[model samples]
Every structure is written in C-alpha cells, then in structure tokens.
Target chain A: MSTLVLPDQQVRVENTTVRHVRPTRRLGASLRKTLYRSGAIIGFLLVWELVPQFVLEPASRVFLPPLHEVLQQLWKMIISGDLGTHIVASLGRSAIGFILAVIIGVPVGLVVAWFAKVGDFLNPLLEVFRNTAALALLPVFTLLLGIGELSKVSIVLYAAFFPVLLNTILGARSVDPLLIRAGKTLGLNNFEIFSKVVLPASVPIIFTGIRMAGTSAVLVLIAAEMIGAKAGLGYLITNSQASFLIPKMYAAILTVAVLGFVVNAALVALEQHFSRWARA
Target chain B: MSTIEIKNLTKKFLRSGANESTAVTAIESLDLRIEDGEFFTLVGPSGCGKSTLLDILAGLSTPSHGEVLVDGEPISGPSLERSVVFQQYALFPWLTAAANVLVGLESQARHGQGPNKADRRARAHEYLRLVGLEGVEDKYPHELSGGMRQRVAIARALAHEPKVLLMDEPFAALDAQTREQLQDLLLDIWKRTRTTIVFITHGIEEAVYLGQKVAVMSAKPGKITEIVDIELQDRQAVDDIRSTRQFGEYRHYLWTLLHRHGRQGEEATIDKTLITSGASA
Candidate 1:
C-alpha cells in the first residue's frame, strides 16, 4: 500500500492558541510598563523632596523635617547599629509568627477542604474568629500569654492565619473536577489524588494567601510592638515621636514601608518559581 | 471470548430540581460484546448516554440494573485493565508530559509488580516516543497544542498497558486536520498494540473509519439500533477510503438510521424545556 500524506486542512492553529505576543520593541513596551508603575512613586518622592525642602522647612522647622534630614537620621542610626537592631527584631518577629501561621494554617486548610463534613462543622466558628480583628484580640492575647514576645507573636499569628487558611481552603476546594476525574480514571485512591493532583494545583492559590498574610503579619506585629517594646521598628517610630525626634520617626516609618514592599516582592518570586508550570 | 461484555446494561439519572424531581433514563437494556483486540466504536446523538455507557464499561459509573464484564469478571470500579480518555484532554496542568504518563503507570494496580522508578521513566519516554512526542517530554500541558495534549493523554493511557481502552470523543476538540491526523495515529497504534478499544464519537465518519464494527445508537433512552461491520479492502490505506462508494454507503446507512431515531429525542427535549419554561412563566 502506498503511503498517502494527509492534506493539511487550512488549519489556523494559531486561532486557538494563546500566546504572549513578542513585541517588536520589547524594551519599549517593558520600559513603558515600568514607567507607568513607578510614575506615582517618582511624583510622590519629587513632591516630598521639593515641597519639604523648599517650602515646609522655612515655614515650620520642628513640625515637618526635610526628606534629606530624615535620610541623614536614617544613615546616622544605621552607622550606630540601632537601626540594624530594630530591623532584625521586627523581621525576626514577623518571620517566626508567619512561619507558625503557615505551619498551622496549611494542614488545617487542607483537612477542611478534603473533608467536607469537617469544613461544614467549622464554618460558623471560623467565620466568627475571622470577623474579629486581631488587633482587638491583642489585649486578650497579652493577658493570656503575657506582655512579651509571646503576646506580640500571638497577635501576629492571629493576623496571618486567616488569609492563608481561607486562601488554601478556596484553592483546595476549587481544584478542577476534570483533573480529579483523570486521577480516578488512572485508578488513584482519594489520598493519592489529593496528594498528587489537588495539593499541587492549590500551591499557587496558597502562595497568594501566604503573600496576603505576610502583609498583615508585619502590620500587626508593628502595632503590637508599639504597645510595649524597646527593640523593634515600631518601638523606634513611637519612641522617636515621643522624644520629639521627627526625622527618626520618619526614617523608621519609611523603613517599615520598604520592608513590607520587600516581603511582598519575595513572596511573588516564590510563587512564580512554584507555579512555573501554570504559565507559558 | 470477548474482552468486554455488556449484559442488559441500564443507567438512570435522577435530576432533582428545586420543587420536583424527574428520572432521566440515560440507557435502557443495552447489550454489547467487544471481542479481544478488536476496535469497536459507538456512534449516537448528543445526550444518547453513549458516554454513560462507556463510563459504566470503565466502571466509573455503575449500571442501575445490569453489569459490565471484562475478561469474564464483573467490573466493580475503575481498574488498571480499563483506562479512559476523556473528551477534554485531561492532562494534569502541573505535570510535564513524561511525568503525566509516569503518573498513570505508577497509579496502576500492577505498579507493585511493575518496573522500578527509572524503568517506569524509560517506559513513559518510550510511549511518548510512540506518540511522536519525543523532544517535548519536559513541556507542560499549557505549552503544548490541543492535539499534542491529547497525544499525551493517549500516551498516558497506553503507558499503563490497559487491556481495554475507552475513549470518550477524545479528538472532538481538535481541528479537522489534527483530528484526521490523530485518527490515523490511533489506527496505527491500535494495529500495533491490538488493544481492545471502545471509542465513542458522534461523528459517523470517525466511527466508521476507526472501528471494525460501528454500533449505531438511539437516544432519549439509549439503545443500539444497528451494528454495521465495515469491511474495507485496504484498512491500512484509509487516506482515500472516504472517497470510495462503499464508505459513502456505510455513512449514508448510519446517517439514515440516526436521522430517523435522533430527531425524536431532540424534539422531546425541546418540548419538555418549553413546557417547563411556560409553567415557570
């Protein structure tokens, strides 16, 4: 029998294809996107530098320090190692609390998602807890765990837990039924399907939760530290403000903002690495 | 002895609405026997319960009153001996093509007696090669074409070495050219492996082309209307077979049978929906 080459029908396979268009001017497109994003930061910084230096300083010296003065104070604190100590203390607390939340939240979320009955039973209780602010619970935690590292960490854990828990539950529950069916057709047991398919699929969404929780963890930790702490970034800000050191207060606040930004960026990188398969 | 035996198989579905419940009879008293190593196809209209029947055969869905026996034993649940290829190429998006195939092998009942990890990896590679996907093993599902993803699904099914392969409109989503290409590829694989295949499709040409015997089914309560034996002179050279008079006659025969029975089910559906909507209004 003679082999016949199949005639290719007008197959516009590209019509069904979803591809990121390679811009003819790749640098231009990316640079434009970057500029659009950083436009607000640049405009804000320019206003901060110009208005505070040129206008505010001459009008009121003690009230609003120039951006340069704040930067200078930040430099001085860095040289004296005080700023480094506060940075370490703040990061350490957030890290410990966030890690604990992840450790507690992930398995609990997976269990609730995997077992519908357990989830249904816990739904009301979780809703109640999730609704109550972690900051509102700070006093109770302080009384229960004492006004120390334990109390501060507890508050931070409370803040961090709900985001991760909720996201993980959503992710696990939303796993594509097609994948579950495929797993069944492959003769995989329920546990095998959960481990091999559901867990892997939920990783991206779990990362999203982790990122959100990390932001809240830092915010709550700083607030908790401000209550009674001598060695954290929050302490630096409140203490400087009470002592009437405007520049130092500004410096501490700026550092905290930068730290939050860095933490979020790191989480995004981790998510990208884990979910490499999800993107083309 | 047949590799698969469907004895008086019936499946009914209960569709419960807000206020009322109705029993939708999907299949009623369907009997089919697929010989070992034979390629059999089931063709029917949409909602004909052809898929329900296939699911029952795969043991993913239980028959309401009867049983599906594979190799002389009644199937209780999904087994390694019978694997399914869903209409949507249900390749795990998280896994690479090779990993997807390996997963099937690892999940099979014979995994305990099967080759070690390295050997299993090699077998996966071999099957991917068999499907003409040699260099794309590391590519994720999103990175591959629709046809390529379906090929990976096929490779995954074949890697487990199932005695009977059940495909549910596997190539229905592909473009025409790719669909024809895959049809040829499947025929080639079936010829080489001689795995007893039960393929389900609404396409009469596809059913006739792929199967030794094509079973035409009717809907509303699905039942086999006819089983036509396709006796082509040169099955290997099927590229120009559709142009032949014999192929057209078979197509015309199946089309007429379907045209007669398929319309009643659809009209009933339209009338029922209209009545329901009128009642609600």
Candidate 2:
C-alpha cells in the first residue's frame, strides 16, 4: 500500500509551472495530500495486523482479527458473491433514503427561504425537530411504520433531511444583497432573479448541506439496519459477530467505511465542479 | 432622448434597532436635471447622498418626497431603459463574462426590441468588445481582475442600449493606472454612444475629468451645493486633459467647494492626493 515511486521529473515541471500557471502546482499538492493520507491509512493497517499478534492474548486475538484474515474473508465473500449481495442491499437502501431526503429537502428549503411567511412558520418547528436526533425516534418509527424497509428508510431520511434543509436555507439567505440589487438594476423580475441570481449563487453552499446529508444517510441507514434489517452491511456485521466470524465482521465494517468515503468523495467532486466552474 | 428631471427629490430611512426613533435622511429636497446625451457627474464626501440619488434615478430606491422623470414621464421601478454600474463591480459571479452581459440583453429580448438569438449573442460579444474586453467571453467574474470585472460590469450595463446609464463610483475600487485607463475608455465610449450618464464619485479630479457638468453635493440632508459646467468640450482632442490648466482649475474649484461645504455632520479631512492632483501644474 505504501509503494509510492518518487517522481524523477518534478523539478523541471515545477519550474515550468512557475508563477502564473497554478493548476499544475495545485494538482501536485493534491497528489501529495492523497499520498500522505494513504500513508497514514497503510500505517494504521500495519498496526492493526501486527498489534494483536504480539500484544493481545490468544483468547482476545479472536476478537481483534488481523488485517490479512479480514482481507482473506473479504476476498472469499467477493468470489462467492455474498459481499455483492450485502453491498447492493445496503447501497440501495442508503441511496433511496438519501435521494428521497434530497428530493423533499431542497425544494422545501428553497421555498421556505424564499417566502418570509413560510420561513417564519417553519423556522421554529424545524429548529425543534433538527435538535432531536433521528435515532431517538427509532422506536416510534418502528412502532408506527413497522419493522420493515419503510421504518429503516424513514430513519435514514430523518437523519439526512435536516442537514440538507438547514444548509439550503442558510445558503439562500447568505446570497449577497449587492447581487440582488444588481439583478434588480439589470431588470430581472422576481422569478427571474430567484432562478438566475439566488439559485445559482446558493448552489455551492447548498452542496455543503447535501454532502453532510450524504454522510448522514449512509451512517444512519447502517444503524437502522443493525436495529431491524435481515440483510445489509450492518446486518452482516452483527450476524458475523454473533456467530464468532470476527474476520467477516471486520470485512463488512471495512466495506461500510469505504462506501461512506466513496459517497463523500463523489459529493466533494460534484461541489468542486460547481465551484471551480464558477471561476472557470 | 433621456432628459432626466429631478423635482424636489428626498429619501429617508428609519434606523433599525437602537436608533429606530430618528429617521436618517439620506437625501433632502434635492433637485437636478440631466439633459439628453449629457455626461453629468456628482461629487461629494463619502456620507453625502450621491449614491442614493443615483439609486433613485436607477429606480432601485424610491424618492421619499418628489419625483424623477425621464423624458417628462415619472420613473416607476427599475427598468431596462435605465441601467446602473455599481462601484463593487456587481457582475454575477456564477456567470461567465458574456453570460453576465447577456443578462441585460435578456430584458431587451423580452420586449421584442432586440435582434434574433444569434444576433443577440453577437451583440453581447460586441458590447464586451466595446468595453475593451476581448478573448474573455468564457471567463467568469472571479477569474478576472477588479478592473476587468468592472469592464464586464460596464458592458452588462450598456448591453441593453439603455437610454440613461447611472454609474455610482464605478472606479473607486480600482488602482490609479486602471482608473485613468477606464476614464479615457469611458470618455471614448461616451463620444460614440452619447448616452445620458449620471456619475457619482468623491474624487474632484474624477468628477471634472468625466462630467460635462460636475455637481458638488453637501452631506447631512444631502443636496447639490453647486453645478459647475465644464467647458472642455474637446476633451477627446486634448493630449492629456487632466494635465491641462483648465482641467486643474475645475478640479481645484470643486475641491474648494467640497472643503468648504463637504460634510455638515462630520469633520472633513484634507485629502493629500487631491492636493497634488488639484494643482494647476
């Protein structure tokens, strides 16, 4: 994992990418950042593999499985298509809940922010709900909606919704009034100004909320699955742990972490595209 | 002809929160007329209501007491016929340079007063070129320098072929070299377009250099103290108008007026730069 080859031609490249052309230096810096992160992760994995062998007793070693055993189990599950099934199940639930949250949250947030009356009414109500954690309402959701996909998805939705909604309101509110005044002088009517100026200006900030919600959706879905679901990454983790399949449990946990990281990376890319395109 | 007429104009804002009792009078019973195709500039200290007056003329703000008329008709709300260039270069950040200019063109297209879609795009390109910004159609506002951004803003303001253009200290944020360059560029553009302009600035040199008639304004119940008609009719023909004796005299006179009746509510600090620029050297 730490097989990083030193780039021999960097000196010439850095000199050529001097003062004006900045993207090359930025790209190099980003690569360096990624390398440092990968190095830390590799260092952690090495510690995980080695620490249990020398430090833990044989009885406790079963609980703290080595990295190679986890990887082996992960590979075996992949070859047998078991990992794929759990991944598909987990991803589908997470995506559905996240998409639904976004669909409901964004427009509602925009409308609420745009209309003073709607904002005045919803602000206090939203403030109350946002403070109350989604997991706190899990039993209520299960009792009302039953221990099915609906309840699980509802938990994810509830977890994800507030971040998206609140951020959107903040983004819309944070639009520069100077821009609005400029829009008026440019002869843009109310709807035109809202669509052209307010909407576009708020997008980068709105994406921040969506990114937070993305993380929440996945995390909350996993927790919800552990509570009720029969087949998901979270369920697999609990099941393998109950059966003393520590390696398989570790593998599932690793998969969930990777999935969460991937989702976050994709959202970060989307946000960067919007913001960078604004300057392009 | 966009003959702007100001009749007993006034504007007041009720102070928010702690000082909500007394209304802040930004402009009080101000009256001024800008003729068709005239290059008019308003000069005052920072607290004076020159920007407020410009905003009222642009219809971004309503007059509290009297009215402003363009071509003998009372101004309503902000319309395409009157465009404004703001000091901060209020170009839309999300849009490319040409796209920002296209925003103003959209108003013309709405009224069927503009050309076809293709010509409109061409016209946006043309307006950008008119402001000396070429090969930057796809560049967004954040990508450009402050001066370039302001040029894009000027292009946007002029894109609709507005009968009157109201500029509120448009070059205040720019560097000295860029400001001078833009001033000459603006003069050249005004020569060709002949659009009625109401420019607001605190600099006496900028006021004299730009306006055919420079209106000196006093702060605290803001009103025009004097309107000095500039006689440098062949300003374009001169080698360096700012260096001319007549130009210096106009700048010095405006500076003296400002020094005497600049701000009624605050102490007027002597500007060091104006002392040299207003010199008849």
Candidate 3:
C-alpha cells in the first residue's frame, strides 16, 4: 500500500482488490421483502374470497359477490371474446389520442423553450389553456366534432397534450449552461449543440412527461367513453351497472385498472431504455 | 511568436432588468500575451476576472473593449483551433469517454481533408490512452471519478489537436494526490505535444509548478497586476524541480503578489463582485 497525504485526509492506495459483498448473502432482508410483497396480494385475495363467503349475508352477496364468482364471470367474458373487444376498443382510442399528443406536444415544447421570442409569445396562452380542464372542454369538442371517435379522441388529446408540452419545456430549458459552453468550445454550432447537449440532458424529464401524458390520455379516454361510447371498457362498466350485473362491471373496472398499470410499466421501460447512460 | 494577444480587453455583465449604468465589470483593460508553445498560467483570487479573461481568450465570450487575437487574427467566436477544458468537467454525461473525445474529432472531421471515421476512432482511443484511461472507452462521465472525468475532458480537448488549449482550473476540484498526478501527466503531455497552453488556477504552487510564466490579477474590475517568469532548467524532472528551493521562491513570489493585490481590492467595498479573488485568503 502507498500512503498519500491530502489537505484534508490521508489516503492509502491498497494493491489488494476488494470484492463487493453480494446483497443476496443477506437472505433475511430480501426474504422478508419478497414475503411482504406476496403476502399483501395473497392476503387481499383471501379477504376478497372470505368476506362474501362467510361474513356477508345472502342478500348482501348479491351486490358483493365472492372472488371465485367474479373470476368465473371474467373467465366467461374472455372465452366469448367480449373482454378482448372492449380492451382493444379502449386501447385503440387511447393510442391514437396519446400518439397525437406526443407528436404535437414534444416539438411545440422544444421550439417554444429553445426560442426565447416564441416562448414569450406563447407562454401566457399555454398557461391559460393548461389551467382549463379537458373534461370541461368535452361539450365544446362534442359540439364541434360530434359524439363520435373524434370527440372522444379530442378529449384525450387535450388531457395528454399539456403534461407532455409543459414537462418538455421544463426539460429543454433546464439544460445546464456549462454543457452548452463546452459544446460551443468544441466548435459545435447552435443546432448541433441543441441536438447533442440539450436534447440528451432533457431526456429524463421528457420521459417523465411522456409517462404523465400516457396516464392522462388513458384516464381522459375512459371518461370520454363513459360519457358516450358503445364498445369500450368504460361503456361495459356503465351498461353492466345499469343492468345490475355487478360482477361484469367489476371485471371491466379491473381491466381498466390493469390496462393503466400496463401503460405506466411500458412507459417506465421506455424511459429506462432511452436513458441507460444516466444510470451509469 | 505569441499565439494569443489581449489588447486592453474588457468585459461587462449587465444586471437583469438593470440600465447600462448598473452594469458590473468583470474584466477591464487587460493586456496580456501568451507565447507560442509555452505553458502559461493566470493566477488570481476569486472575482479577479481570470475566468473572464480565459473565456475571452477562448472566444466563448466577446470582450466589451479592445480585442483578443489568436495567431494575429481577431477571435470572432469559438473554433476548433482553440479548445477549452472547463473546470466543471462538462464531459457530456450522455457520451462515453471515447465518444466524448470523438465529439472534438467529429467537428474537426466535418471540414475537408480531415480524418476518416476509422482514423477518428483510433485518435480518440489514442488520446484516452494518453490520459492513462485504457479499457474504459465506454465509461460515461457519471460512472467515472472526478479525476477521471477531468482527464477525459483533457483528452477531449487534446483530441482535436488544437493550436491552443485553454484550461480553467481543471484540477481545482480534485484531491491533492490526483491533482499532483494530473499535473505531472499534463507536463508530460505538454512536452510531447508542445501546444501553447493557457492554464488558469487559484493555487500559487500549481501556477509555479505548471507554468513557465504566471500572470497575477487584481479583483473588482479585474486586470493583470504582475507577470512572473519561472526559469526551470529541467522541465522533465518536475518532482525534483518542485522539491528544489528555487520552486519555493517562485511560489512565494507569486503568493505575495496575489496576497497584495487581493488585500488592496478587498477594501474597495464593491458589493457587485461578491466572489472572492482566486487566492484562498
């Protein structure tokens, strides 16, 4: 070992390499975590199964059916391809609206943020529009485009756009000045600097925006479908409820919840893929 | 021949929403010349405009008065011929070490009669090796240590084969041992490359050890107060030279010059220049 003295501390540079201890070696900690996660789900299912089976009277069980009955109903829906139809319908509308929001929002955000004159011109109007709710604009969209796919998609678009645009603006503007200067010193022009330095720096935030937009788009699509749609999960829930089919309504609600979770997971995966450099 | 010449250069920063009369002067009427292929250092306390001066020389910032000429021509803006190693590392966190160096080569390669893609990769690898970073071609800036990041920045600056390398306290953030190690490595690189270097630092010992000539600056509307010539017969044996009494004398002289100027400027009571001069005092 060679010893070196610094202004604040003495450092010993050891020739012998140190091995990292495996986290798995601490079995108790990891085992408890696994057990806790599994226990929560299993425990929840047990309560769902038992509450209606033992605690609830026959009359109450009419509204809150046992877990197995609900599962049976869901299974029947799947076999008949009804669940698949509703899922595909909901996903298609959400996809179209969210994708449109991304295409328009990202570039508009970057352009406004990068160009000061443009940002100054648009910021006040953006804030005003963002504050006004997408749900509130439902009547306006229906009046303009009619109660069809366009109106439903437009509402989702409105809901998804602001989050992506606002977050993107924040991302592009928050790029460190030091990095910009470094690019300049390396003889990169403004366009090159923006593409190389600013864009990469903004990736993490932009992904956050995308994730937010995805969630918002799914939410707004469901709400729009609830207001006026025939084949989607939202319509399935409302129709089943009106007809007193509690199990089918619960299945539709569960499907929508699962779909939202899946969308979030997919977005998280995309964020991880694009910003792997940051994890380093 | 002087590679860089500053003739009465000045820089003023306008306060936000403030009129012209409220502008703060970062540099004023500074005249300096850096010789070709020479290791020159600018040492001053905080707010002494040493960074401003370097920025002006790098052509990253325009001088409000007079001009900075590189190779007898005025510097209009940043060019591939003059590159800088920023104090913050600024290694483009998204890029790996090799790719960071490649950024310089890519820009230079855009012009005709430049290195091909294969040669540019080879040169990037060569520079990384020169900075003693091997088998880490794919390591991103965030994955590396502070010293390693600075070394990558140094390698990136050198990869372009710039006529002048401008470094703004590149070692200021490193530990003593790492700083010393980098100092020795830099001297070795300087000997081999023989590129004109203008290094900025706050440490008197660093200035004495690395530079053939050191310029000291005063704070509050900063300007160069003194320039000291360092005569070292053996630049190769830097460790031995640093241990000699002559090195102590040079360090002491520069320290005294900085101390005097720092004290004189401290009493001015100018609230605008809150940053202490380069001197630790």
Best by DockQ: 1
Candidate that beats the other on DockQ, 2 or 3, i.e. the better one: 3
Interface RMSD, all candidates in order, equals 4.2, 15.9, 7.1
The TM-score that candidate 3 achieves is 0.91
Name the 10 consecutive residues with the lowest summed lDDT in model 2 chain A.
A1-10
Candidate 3 lDDT over residue span B156-265, tens digit each: 99998999999999999998888987887788788778899999999998998899888888899898887877776655544567676666667666666777664664
Clash pairs for candidate 1:
none
Model 2 complex DockQ against the native = 0.30
CAPRI level of candidate 3: acceptable
Misplaced by over 4 Å in model 2 are A1-34, A277-280, B17-20, B262-281
Question: Residue-wise lDDT of candidate 2 within A76-119, one digit each (tens)?
Answer: 99999999999999888888888888999999999999998999
**TM-score between candidate 1 chain A and the true chain A:** 0.89
Residues forming the 10-long window of minimal summed lDDT in candidate 1 chain B: B267-276
Best-first order by DockQ: 1, 3, 2
What is model 2's interface RMSD? Answer: 15.9
All candidates' lDDT scores? 0.86, 0.86, 0.85
* lDDT (Cα, tens digit) per residue for candidate 2, span B1-281: 39999999989988777845678999999888899999999999998988888888888889889999999999999988899999998888888899999997886787677777898899999988877777789987776777788888999999889999999999999988778878877887787888998899989999888888989998898999888877665665778888986677677777777887634454434443454454423
Model 2 TM-score is 0.91
TM-scores, each model vs. reference: 0.91, 0.91, 0.91
CA-based DockQ, model 3: 0.40
